[model samples]
Target: MGSTMFIELHAFSAGSHIRGTHIEASLIGLKRHALTNRYKMQTSINCARNSDKSYHEQHKVANLILPYPIEREEFCLCVFTTKHHISQHPQRGDRRSVLNDSQPDKNHKHRHLYFDEATITVSGGQGGDGEAWQTSKTKTVKNFKYKWGTNSQKFIELPAAEPADGGRGGNVYIRVDRACDSLLHIHKRKFWRAKKGYHGSSAPHSTPGRERPRLALTQEDLYISVPAGTVVRRKRSGELIADLTSHGMAILVAEGGAGGIAARPSQQMYSRRQKKEKEVSDVGLEISPRVTTSGEPGEVVTLQLLMRVVADIGIVGLPNAGKSSILKAITRATPDIASYPFTTLMPNLGVIHCERIVSEKLIDIDHETCALPVIADLPGLIKGAHKGRGLGRAFLRHLRRTRAMLIVVDASGQDPVSDYTTIREELRLYNPEYILRPHILALNKIDFEWAALRVQEIKAEVQSLEESAVGPAPIAVLPVSAVSGSGMDILISELMEAMRLCDEELSIVRGSAMDSRDKSDSI
Candidate 1:
């Protein structure tokens, strides 16, 4: 419900003694001054009036309930009520706020906001203006009074304005929020502006001659929250500014302007009785007292935000290749799966714990949560994917930060080897760096007799091709049926091992690069 108003007053105040008779004023302004501000609206109020004096025959106080609209009469009495869905303060939640309550699922209502790229404008707040004092030779104060004999008192005039300095403006920053899994929250918003600074003010008990020392209140800074792995870039120049990869990482996007100062008066005195060297020159810099500095403008920037999902392993395959099914079987991800292509438009992420080999068997380690393999089920790719066919470019970028790839192929397809080659070629054309990452082959749909018959042939061909490859070779080839869960245990172990090796290689590369940079800096 919208805001409702409340009003309570006496009808005697509405019209004071008209023809020496009191008339009830229904929603009209009170004639008598409200000493306690009781006339102020609580929420909002609606009043109905009966101008005729016939309704004023009863001179008794009554409690009025609104909404019936049955002609309310008397001194104005107003009250308001609101629904729970309506927030009292939108900027912050109150005790009655339902924002913290469990939300109802409206299937894919905000799916459009899950885009990978977005353009936005961000700005920082302007700084406050500095304070100043009036010029005077001596302290301006009231003189004491003598009470005895002929009592006399002297009073000094005080300025009308308050003596205080303006507060500083807030700065804008980009912070990574772990709860934000996507750019959905900020994608729809086109412009972001921080609050401006306060105007100039003076200190308390300050006079034209002297200013009291005091601490100024600082302003709060503004922070725009985005998901981890969001890359902030300048829209016009395409310059990379910040890359927030991990949670709790943040960067300053714009700096607030510095506050300005007001003109303070200074005295100039010269004496001829002093020596020539002691004589002071009257020529000096001077600022006019009428000058009052205003706040500086905030920084405004148009930015392009690109988000790449950071996962340990990425699943790549053609449309209708059972990638989602394989991911579902491995972890607890319930992705949209169908025989048709492009079923999984947005990427889906699932986590699987790392295991250690004990007694020649896989054992889950409870404390290995830090480096658990996070599997990403990306949207399927098609022919000419690198040429922007089937939204492949957007899907391919999700693999940029992954440690390894899990390529799933439909074993029932006419040519499993050709499909595997097509996927590899697409990755190579999109980015050669992707080929350098470890890759695993999972021949899906092996439960069918016809597909199972050709699984060994496909596996052998893929291994032979991998042996001929340069750096990015297929780590292992395994035939598994997502529907029947055949060979899933061994397939999972191989994928885990491949992910571990890939992570170690990446860490070594990063460490070597850091060492080289250090050496250069020392030189």
Candidate 2:
């Protein structure tokens, strides 16, 4: 009967029939099969249900369904067994694949941005304390007594000794190191202090009185490392402390205090007793030594560290003015190059070696000499830069240290003349003395079709401004193509010459000042 029922159920499930007669026959066969294996079927159904629930909880299955008993028990058993096997034996490669899928692409990149300014508090170490001590001696005689009675000698107290000197406080020093690239190190540290000196020890045999040994006299100095081209100034007074332009340069920021002096010796002294005594006596004494003074405290000061790029020539221009392109063409610096504006957020430095041949007529010996000048490609400046516009006064300070400036203008841009004037006015407004520095006007992108006309108009406008005394006279105007390397040689030569002339003029002024000072000193 069971065999017949199983065959009938299989036939019903195999064929797709939704008729009432087929349904009734399948239900009857399912009831007969359950009765034949009542205990086994109940256990299998419970196990399947538990497996399904466990699988859903562990694997997070979105939607799951169990087949009807009459349809096919084998299908339901296979599905649940497969899920259980997977749960027990997960593949190693599957986990790795999942992790890889969750991570971002390896080609993704990031940049580390650094600040140029920071404020920090620095202090020197405090001095050590002084100590004091004293010594004492006692003597007794066992000689014959007088007619009156026997007596004993009293305890004698010795004079107190001077205390040792205290140790000197430590000093704080700021040093410039080339290994540091930015002010990031000092920015993280808000306060710095030096180690204090050790205290002095008291002398032996000294009484516990108002005297003690002076503190140990030694000074400890703290050295702070900073990047080259850092300018340190007082935070409160705004006083300029030092300008560290070269590597290994250092300055004393805070000075340690002097050590305390030892205590003076006591005036009173006790001598041995000469008279003899027949009676015996006991003498006991105690003395307390005290420290004279403690060392003075070191200086505490707040300082501001400002970093500026050290370069001989600074390139200034508007966005997309080909400044970075020219820097790349002239030197080996690799600045970010893109058609978009503000591509360069930080300053890039490059070295330009200018070679010159001296003729015998001009100089006694003819030789080729090279002047290696550092060039800085600064961030682009926009209108109202002085008023804190795009990349505003943050970068303007970099120009202050430059000996010469190169104003790169986009000849292809509309109204190149206006661009030049705007940049000049912004510089003048930011610092009136900046206008006095020698500068070269570089009309870039001369390969453009209308660039020639724009160059001509810019030159005319510059001339008119000079005639009207609107600004200082520029060194010269040179047309150059950063893309094609056109007029680059002329631009370099002019920059070198301008730097040379400025140096000569500076030397002459320094010489005159020294001569006047000597004459006045002699008088």
Candidate 3:
């Protein structure tokens, strides 16, 4: 006996969003329904009677099919941002996490990053075959009205109608439900592909003689649910994916196939009525990340989040520079105050309430936005940061987006002057524009016993460079004790002054450029 059709599961592509709920809009012009009660009853009985069981034993035994399997025809919305390159392998390998191009992380690894419980590839159903039949009956013998006396013959012939294409394969879908949290569904599967078309019948046959059911190709839809503010990113290029701000917004990725040729109608049935079954228009795929209310950052998946635009002043220096300690003293925000480098990954924001003397001037208001700003604790830059050594470019990129830069140098380091130059050079390499931003030098750790002597030497060196160079090396070299909370007020004041000066210079440049343009136009 021929075996029942064995269903195959397709792997949804990475970054494809699968929905947990059904999409009513895409179902238009298609027949989507569960089996009738009686049909379902018979199917359950037959399934239970069968002794041989396979992977889908429970689902088959119950005859509980999904009413609308293709929830949304779209998956993989980020595909447009990705640059495609032809390759022999069907699966894609990510270069950032895995070094080797040949190895792809198991599909289930990034489940936490997606919005839906599953991501799957959908295929269309196969069409049924057609059949042909004929009948021959004659009464003759050149007799009168009573032909019963004459000889009569009758025969029937039937033509073979080829089977219509297998009902196109069922489309794949990714479903997200309230019970799920991560994208654990994709882990179990590899890739998703639609079902192939079935062959046509050998001969013409009507309804009863037809061997298969009439199946219009139906596309499989995939859906996923991720956290709100979850950024969807293109896998290969490491670019920002979708910023899923809304709950139900879906993005389309891939489309399904068109239907094959239809059967011919008979000429003899002049008065017969005919109906046309709509073909499977297309299949769609989309990968969307869900937006969640949780403030906690989501797990790292394909992309990296660099908090640049969010923060203003980034506190950076050598180990033991007291960057974290200073941050605690300035703002109520609690960053671990330890004499160590790499203390903070997330930036801390603080409000610097202006003192009586500072708040009196109009310029002070302008300084507030630029000077007293949200500070970020960036990983310290070592000698080789420009070349991407020791969290090099990553740290620098974070600083690049800041309006101003702050160098928290160690007062007791062997060479504070050299440290400042090293940092400036690295910044220049990362972005030449960084040099244009107003920056200051803060000699921290002044409470250390040896810091007095070191602070003097460093201040002299910086002052001497200021005299020799056309412009100042930095506005001033202020000594600060992060432990004792000393010199913070003065440092804040200096930052305000520098911001005011920078703003004035910017205004002057804009005015001069505009004036020059007017002069040219007049001439």
Candidate 4:
């Protein structure tokens, strides 16, 4: 054999086998080395040429037998092409599979950091004490001088002095913040208190009963930032405080205390009411801390904060039911997905954009006019989920704020009808009103021939309501393949329509509430 150069290829081939002296040219790419590195595997020989096909054509995957002692230019071209492809798509386990190939975490990273409910104690600041004269001092007033001679001047006496009034305390308020998505920050600390008010000082030269100093100042109110859609309520009584839904919306939870009244002079007797003065004891009532009025205590209350994830459409399904896949196919959110149950432990949010088609391309999808809907993919539910089984309470709580529901049933599962029934029952058990909400049924994993064939049967079975059915039927049932991206358009359109109807219903309810409020005000 003539003198030839050999390129020892390593274990770079993925899934495909290399037998005898022939090796498949397909490689998983150079791992942990440069371009000219040798593959630490068995040697390969023999080469097959396909000069007719392009590099990226979907013709056929043949054994890449490298012909040794070949020209340097051709050899460099093949290796470089393989390297470029590997770099561009480093996450692809299989070329035709889903875009992300990384395995999901055993315990999802987001599930641990999530915080939904918190119990907090908030109090307004205490009012500052009214100040009184600390020590007694002798004051000399000019005595009236009359006609001793014509040059004598008349004198005046000073009015009695009063103690200074105190400043008001700070208030506690809860405000909505768009940037904050979790209550974890507030959950860390259970108590929130406002700054105390500044004390007042007496003015000696002022008029009687009006000797408050000008330096006394009240504290600024304290504002706690919470994510939109947070519902505050009295912890003990369960009375609703406020539903902070919009950005910049705020409400006062606790009010500050009133300032203490200053002590009066010995000549003027102290009175409880402002109407008239009652002559009290005048013995040793000079102006001591005991004689003077003290500050009033502020209001204290314990509040329960519940965080509801606000969204337009909610995705519900059984575990490994392709809910995450549907979300990824429609929106840009990349959730951790595996072929196992409980893969998605936390909710994922995404925005659904609507665009118009013009001349075979996307056009004028103005955000202001054609507003997008924010969708959430919630965790899967099992039987008895409403009773706190498998994070059921959290999943149900998060769904309360969604405008519409998208029930995704795995068509490839043992029983798609049973899965849908379980999810619906769980929702109804948690909140009966949830059954009345608009729903869109989605039969996912229809790419398989068997699943596709059973789609109509599953839809028919779900249509015949159970004996305990309490609400309207689903708007529509669609067969979709989240992995292959088929039938997603119709499913999305149905969901958008359902969301629109829900929004209209909400607007009608709001309008009626406003009208009733106006009538009461007029009356």
Clash totals for all candidate models = 17, 23, 74, 3
**Candidate 1 per-residue lDDT over residues 1-523, each given as its tens digit:** 3344333333232212111011123223222322224444432333323343334233211122132111224334323232111122212222122221222211123352356677778877787765654521233457566454565656555554332345567778889998887776664345666776664553334444553332135567888888878999999999999999999998888776655444333221111112211332355434344453455677888888889999989999999999999889878779888988888888998876333233346644445453557899998988898888887687788898998899999999989898988888888889888887888889999888999999888877876776334345688888899899887778778877886687688799999999999999999
Clashes of 2: 23
Candidate 2 at 40: error in angstroms?
52
lDDT of each: 0.65, 0.64, 0.45, 0.67
Top of the candidates by TM-score: 1
Better of 2 and 4 by lDDT: 4
Compose the digit string of candidate 2's lDDT tens values, residues 305-343: 999988889999999999999999877888898898889
For model 3, how does the per-residue alpha-carbon lDDT over 177-295 read when each residue is reduced to its tens digit?
33332343333333433343332332223344553433333434444433222334445575664544334544332223333323323322111111111121233322111110111
Measured by lDDT, the strongest candidate is 4
- The sequence of per-residue lDDT tens digits that candidate 4 reaches over residues 186-256 is 74345677877666563234543543333347679999999988999999999998998888999999887
Error of 4 at 308 (Å): 1.8
TM-score of each: 0.66, 0.60, 0.44, 0.63
Error of 4 at 54 (Å): 47
